[model samples]
Target: MNLSDSRRASIAWLFLCFAWGTGFVAAREGVKYAPPFLFAGLRVLGAGLLLLVICLLTKAKLPNRRQLATLLTMGAVIEGFTNICIAFAVFYLTSGMLSLMLATTPFWMVGIESLKPQGDRLSSRHTVGLAIGFTGMVGLLAPKLIGVSYNSHLLMGCLVMQGACVSISFGSLYVRHQRLGVAPFMGAAWQMISAGVIVVLVGTLRGEWVRWHFTPQVAKPFFYLLLIPSMLGYSCYVYCLPRIPLALFSLHRYINTVVTFLLGWLILGEKFGVGECFAVVVIFTGVFLVQNSSFTVSKKEPSS
Candidate 1:
C-alpha cells in the first residue's frame, strides 16, 4: 500500500489493459490475410515456443499427467475454441458486436460458480442486473437481425462466438480451482502449445494450411500477432490473473468492448448508430452493476 509499490502496480495494470485492448485488434487484423485457423495456430504456437524457451532457461518442471490433461482442456477452451469462434463470428458480426457479446463472459462465470456447493452465492440484484445486461446486448444487436435473411452460416457463427466465451469462462474456472502448482508463464506455455498444435492439425485437415499464402500486407499483421498480442499480451494476462481480484479483472472485458468498438470505428470504419451507443452504455453499466453489486454499499471501495 506504500506509494512506490502502488505506483508500480498501477503502471503494470495500465500496460496490461492496453495490451488486452489492442490484442483483439491484432487478432482481427491477422485474420484478414491468413486463414482464421492458421492465423490463430501460428500466433499461439509462436508464443508457446517463446514461453517454452523461457521455462527451460528457468528450469521449470513439466506437468504431471493429470495436470497435462487439464492443460490440454484449457488450451482447447481458452485458445483453440475462443480463437476459432470469434474468427467465424467476425465474418458476420462487427468486431464491436462480437466483443460486446463476449463481454457477457463474467456473468457466465458467476452463474457457473453459483452451481457449486461452496461457491459464491449470487444476490438477487446480481441476477436482475444480468438479465438487464442481456437485454441491452439484444438491443445492441437487433439491427443486425433485420432484413438479413437467416442462414445456417450466420447462425453458426453466432453460436460459435457465444460458445467461445462460455468455454473460456469454464476453462478459467477450472484454472482457478485446479491449482496447477506452476508459474503462470509455465502453465500458459503448455496451454498455448497444446492449443496451437490442435488448431494447426484441425486447420490442415480442413484444408486451411494449403490455402494459406504469405504476402507483405498479411505478413505484417501476422508478425504483430506473434510478438504483441500472442506473446506479450497473454504473458501480461497470465501474470496479472492471480494478482488481481476476479471481479476487478472482469472490468477488462468491459473495457475491451469499448476499445474494440472505438478501434473498429476509427481504424476499420465500422458504423455505430444511436441504438448501438445507447446499448453499449446500458449493457456495460448493467455488467458493472452485476459485477460490483455485492459491494455497492461501500461506494468507492473496490470489489474483491
Candidate 2:
C-alpha cells in the first residue's frame, strides 16, 4: 500500500479500537437519562438505517425469503435478546464489570456446542479450563451471593448479562450453521433493522417512551454510540478484516475488554479492587487455555 493508504488504515484501526472499547460505557451513560430499552432500541435502529444506506450505495445484494427468514431469526437472538438484556444489565452493573463478564462467552459457547451429537470432544485440559472459568465467574459475583453488601438489582443485572451471553453464543452458532453465503454487511444490516423494530415496539409497549427525554446529557453519548461503534467502527471492521489475519482481527475482543476496563476506571470512576483484580486474572487465564485448546484456524471473511 502507498503511504497515504497506509496512514488512513492506521487511523481507522485507532478509531475502531476507541469506538468498540468504549461502547458499553456509552450505553451505560446514555441509559441514565433515557429508559434503557428505548435507548438501546433507538441506537441499533439508527445504526441499522445508516448502514443500510451505505450498503445500498455499494450495491450489496438483497436476501431472498429463506435467507431473510434465517437472518431475522438470528437477529431475534443476537439483537433482540442480547441488546434488551444488556440495556437493563448496564442500568445496574458498572460497564467495566459488564465487559469482563462478557469475556466468558466462549465458555458458554462450548457448553452449548457440546450438547450437539456432532459436537467436538473436549480434552481433559479443556474441561479443566471450563471449570476454572466458571469458578472465577462465581467469585466475581460472590459478594452479591454472600450478601456482603449485596444488591438484588446488581445480582439481577449480572444474571441478565449472562442471558445475553447465552443469546450471543446461540446466535453465533446459528449463523455458522446456516452458512447462507449472504453478504456479511447486507446480512448484518437486515438482521439489525429487523431486531431494532421488534425491540422498539416492545419498549414502546413497556412505556419506555414516556421515560425517554432528549436532554443534552443523553444526546452526546447516544449519538456517539449510534454513529461511532455501531456504524463507523463496523465499517472499519469490514475494511480491515480482509487486510489482516482472522486471529489478529479477533484480538479486538481482548483489546476491547482491557480498554473498556481502563476507561471505565478513568471516566466513570468504577472501582477495581483486589478481589476484582484476582478474578480478572483467573478468568482470562481460563479463557486463554480454553481458546487455545479450542482453536480452529479460520479464513478472513469477505467484507461484501
Candidate 3:
C-alpha cells in the first residue's frame, strides 16, 4: 500500500478504537434508562438495519446458506453474549474497570489459540507477559481481594467481563479460521443482525423488553451506540483487518483502555486512585509486551 493509503487506514483504525473506547460510557448511560438487554438489542438492531440498507444500496452480494450460518453463530457469541455480559457487568463495574478487564482479551486469544491445531505456540516472552498481565489483574482487584466477602458483586462483575473477553476472543479466532470471502461490511451487517435477533429474543424471554422504556435521555446514548460504535466503529475495524497484521492491530486495545479510563473519569466522575492508576500502567505494560512478542512470531489473521 502507498503511504497515503496507509495513513488513512491508520486514521480509520484510530477512530474506530476511540469509538469503542467511548462506547463503554455510552452503554453505561444507556442502561440507566432502559433494561440492559433490551437496550443492547435495540442498539445493535438499529446498526444492523443501517448497514443492511447500505449493503442494499451498494448492491452487495448476500451471503450463502453456510456463510449465513457461520455469521449468525459468530454474532450470537461475539456481539450478543458479549454485550449482555457487559450490560450486566456495568451495573456493578465502572466503565473503566470493564475496559481494563477486557484488555485481557489478547491473553485469552493466545491461550486459546495455543490449544488449536497448527496454532501459534507460546514463547517464553508470552509466558512472562501472561504472568505479568494476570498480576496486573490481581492489582486491579486488590480492593476486592482484601475484602472479598463484601464485594461479591464486584467479583461477579469482573468474572462476567472476563466472560465477554473470552467470547470475543473465540469470535476472533472463528473469523480467522473461517476466512470468509464475504465483504467486510456485509459480514458485519449479518453478524449484527443475527446478534440483534438473539439478544432481542433473550430480552423478551427475560421480560426485559416489557420493562424497557423509551425517552430522550435514553435515545441520545442509544443512537451514539448504534451509529458511532456498533456501525461505524465496526465498519472501520473490518476495513482495517485485511490491511494490518493481527498482533499490530490488536495494540488498539491499549488505546481503548486508556481512552475508556480517561473518559470514565472525566465524564462519568468514575474514581481512579493511585493504586488503580498503577494497575492500569502495569496492565498496559504487560499488554505491550504480549503485543510485541506476538508481532515477531504470530501469523497474520482476521479479527472479528
Candidate 4:
C-alpha cells in the first residue's frame, strides 16, 4: 500500500484497539448488576440480531451445515464458556488483575502450539521471554492468591478468576483453528447467537432470570453492553480485518493490555503497584517477541 493508505490503516488499528480496551471496561461495568452469564447472553443475542439484519440487507447467505456446526462449537467454547468464567471471576477479582491474568493467553497459546509436530517450534528466545514475562505476572497476582484465611468468598473468587483466564485462552485457540466460509461478521454473528442461547439456558437454570431486576439504573449499562461494545466492537474488528496487515494486527493484544489497565484504574479504582507495572512491561515485551518471531522453518531436502 501507499504511504497514505498505510498511515490510515495504522490509525484505524489504533482506534479498534482502543475501542476494545474501553469495551472491556464497559462490559465489566454491565455485569455488576446482571449475572455474568445473563449479561453475556443479552450482549450476544442483541448483537447477533443486529448483525443478522445487516447481513439480510446485504444479501448474505446463511451458513451451510458444516459452517453451522463450526459456529456452534466455537460459540460453546469461546463466547459461551469464556463469558461464564469471566462473570465468575468478576465476583472475586478486580478487573485490572483479571485483565492481567488474561494477558497470559499468548504464552499459553505459544506453549500449547509447541507440542504440534508440523507447526512452528518454540525457540529458546521465546521460552526465555515467556518465562520472564510469566514470572512477573505471577508476582503481580501472588499477593491476592496468598493467605487462605481471608474471607471464604474471596478464596472462591480467586478460583473463578483463574478459571476465566483458562476459558479465554481455550477460546482463542479454538478460534485459531476454526474454518468458516461466510463473511467474518456473519460467522461471528452465528457464534454470538449460539453462545447467547447457551448463556440464557444456563443463567435461567441458575435462577438468574427469576431474580433479575430491570430498573433504568441497571438497564442503562445492559443496553450499552448490547449495542456498543458487544455489537459495534465485534463489527468494527471484522470490518478492519480485510483491510489490515497481519503484523500490525498482532498489536491488538498489547493495546488491549494498556486499555484494560487504564479503564480499570479510571472506572473501577483499581491500582497497580510497582510490581504490577514491572509485570505489564515484561508481559508486553514477551507478547511482542512471540508475535514477531519467525517460529516456522522449512528447508527442502537435498535432491536424491
Candidate 5:
C-alpha cells in the first residue's frame, strides 16, 4: 500500500479500536440506568437499520433469500448473544472485568478450531500460550469457584458471558468456513437486524419495558453505542480488513482491551487492584505468544 493508503488505514484502525473499547463503557453505563435487554435491543436495532439503509442507497451486493436463514442464525448467535450477555452481566461485573475476560476469545477460537476435522495444526508455542492463558483464566475464576470474592449471581453471570463468547467464536468459524457468498456489509446488516429483533422480542416478552423509562441520562450512552460502536466501529473494521493485513488487524483486541481497562478505571471508577494488574500482564503474555506462534490465524470477527 502507498503512504496515503497506510495513513488512512491507521486512522480507521484507531477509530475502530476506540469504538470497540468505549462500547463496553457505554453498555455498562446504559444497563445501569436502563433495562439491560431494551437498552441493548435498541442500540443494535438502530445500528442495523442504519446499515440497511446504506446498503439500499449504495446498491450493495446483498445475500439472497436462501442465505438469509444462515446469516440470521449467525447474527442471532454472535450479536444477539453478545448483547444479551453484556447487558445481563454488567449488573454484576464491571466493564473492565468484562474486557479482561473477553480477551480470551482467541483461546476459545483455537478450541473450536481444534474440534473441526480439517483444522490446522498448532505449534509448541501455541500450546504453551494456551496453557499460560488458561492458568490466568483459572486465577480469574478461582474467586467465583471457591466462593472467596464472588457470589452465586456473579458466578452465573461469568458463565453466561463465557457462553456468549463461545457462541460467537463458533458462529464466526462456521460463517468463514462456509464461505457464504455475500458481501461483508450486507451479511453483517442482516445479522445485526436479526439479532436486534430477537433481543427486542425477548425483552418485550419479559416485560423489560415496565422497568425501562427512557431519560436524557440514558440517551448519552445509548446513542454512543448505537452510532459509534454498533455502526461506525463495524464500518471501520470492514473497511480496514481488505485494506490492511490480518496480523495488523489482530492488534485491535489488545488495544481495545487496554482501552476498556483504562477507561473503566478513569471514567467508571472501577477497581483495579493487584489481581487485576497480575491478570492483565499474564493474560497478555499468553495472547502475545499465541498470536505470534506462527499458526495460521483467521481474520477479525465481523461482529463487534
Candidate 6:
C-alpha cells in the first residue's frame, strides 16, 4: 500500500479501536433507560439489520442450511449469553475494570482449546503464561476475593464477565473448527440476528418491555453502540484484515483496554489506581508472552 493508503488505514484502525473501547460506556449509559438485555438486543439487532442490507447490496452469498444452523448456535453462545453476562456485569463493575477482566479472553480461549482431543498440547511457555495470567487476575480481584472488600455482587459480576469470555471463546473455537465457506460479513450478520432474536425474546418474557423507555439519554448511547462499535468498527476490521498482519491487528485488544481505562476514568469517574495499573501491565505482559509463544498447534496437525 502507498503512504496515503497506509495513513488512512492506520487512522481507521485507531478509530475502530476507540469505538470498541467506548462501547462499554455507551452500553452502561444505555441501560439506564432500558433493561440490559433489551438494550443489548436492540443494539445488535439494529446492527444486524443494517449489515444484512449491506450484504444484499454487495451480493454476499447467503449461508446454506448447515451453515445457518452453525451460525445460529454460535450467535446463541457468543452474542446472546455473552452479551447478557456483559450487560449484567456493567451493572456491578466499572467499565474500566470490566474491560480488564474481558482482556483475559485470550487465556480462556487457549485453555478451552486445549480441552479438545485434537487441540494443542500445553507447552512449558503456555503453562507459564497461564500461571502469570492467573496471578494477574488474582491480583486484580484480591481485595474482593480475600474478604478485604468482600462484595458478593461484585464477585458475581466478575465471574459473569469471565463466563462471557468463555462463551465467546467456545464460539470462536467452533468457527475455527468448522471453517464455514460463508463470507465473514454474512456469517456475522446472521449470528447477530439470531442472537438478537433470542435475547429480545428472553427480555420480553422477563417483562423488560414494561420497563422500556425511549428517552434521549438512552437513545443517544443506543444509537452510538449500534452504529459506531457494532457496525462501523466491525466493517473497519474486515476492511483492514487483508491489509495488516494478524499480530498487528491483535494489538488493538490492548489499545482498546487502555482507551477504555482512560475514558472510564475521565468521563465516568471510574476508579483507576496503582493496583489497577500494575494488574493491567502483568495481565497484558502475560498475553504478549502467550501470543509470541510457538505453543499453539495448528488444526491441520495430526493427533496421535
Which candidate comes out best when scored by TM-score?
6
Question: What TM-score does each of the candidates earn?
Answer: 0.87, 0.89, 0.91, 0.86, 0.92, 0.93
lDDT of 3 at 264: 93
lDDT of each: 0.75, 0.81, 0.85, 0.72, 0.83, 0.85
Sliding window of 10 residues with minimal summed lDDT for model 5: 292-301
> Which runs in model 3 stand beyond 4 Å of their true positions?
244-248, 295-304
Writing each residue's lDDT as its tens digit, candidate 2 over 1-304 gives: 7788766766777777788899998987887788888888888888888888888999999888999888888786688888888877887889887887687888888778776666666766678889888888888788767746778887898889889889888887776667787898888788888778777877899998887888999899989999989988988887777765555566676678888989898988888888987887888877776776753323355789
Q: Candidate 4, residues 1-304: lDDT per residue as tens digits?
A: 7788767666767767776677557667767776777776777777887888898899989889988888888887777877776767666666665666666677767776776555457887778778777676666556666786345555676466556666666676667775566777788888888888888878888889866777675688777767766776676677567678777787786777688888899888877778778877877777777666766553446789
lDDT (10s digit) by residue, model 6, range 167-232: 888887776768789998998898899888878888898899989998888889988999999999
Against the hidden true structure, what lDDT does model 5 obtain?
0.83
On the 0 to 100 scale, the lDDT of residue 189 in model 6 is 94
Model 3 agreement with the true structure over 18-97: per-residue lDDT tens digits = 99999999888888889988888878987998998999899999999998888888888788998788878989999888
| Model 5 steric clash pairs | none
For model 5, the superposed segments whose C-alpha errors exceed 4 Å read 143-150, 296-304
Better of 2 and 4 by TM-score: 2
lDDT-wise, the better of 1 and 5 is 5
| Lowest lDDT 10-residue stretch of candidate 1 | 294-303
How many collisions between residues are there in candidate 3?
0
Preferred candidate (TM-score higher): 2 or 3: 3
Which clashing pairs does model 4 show? none
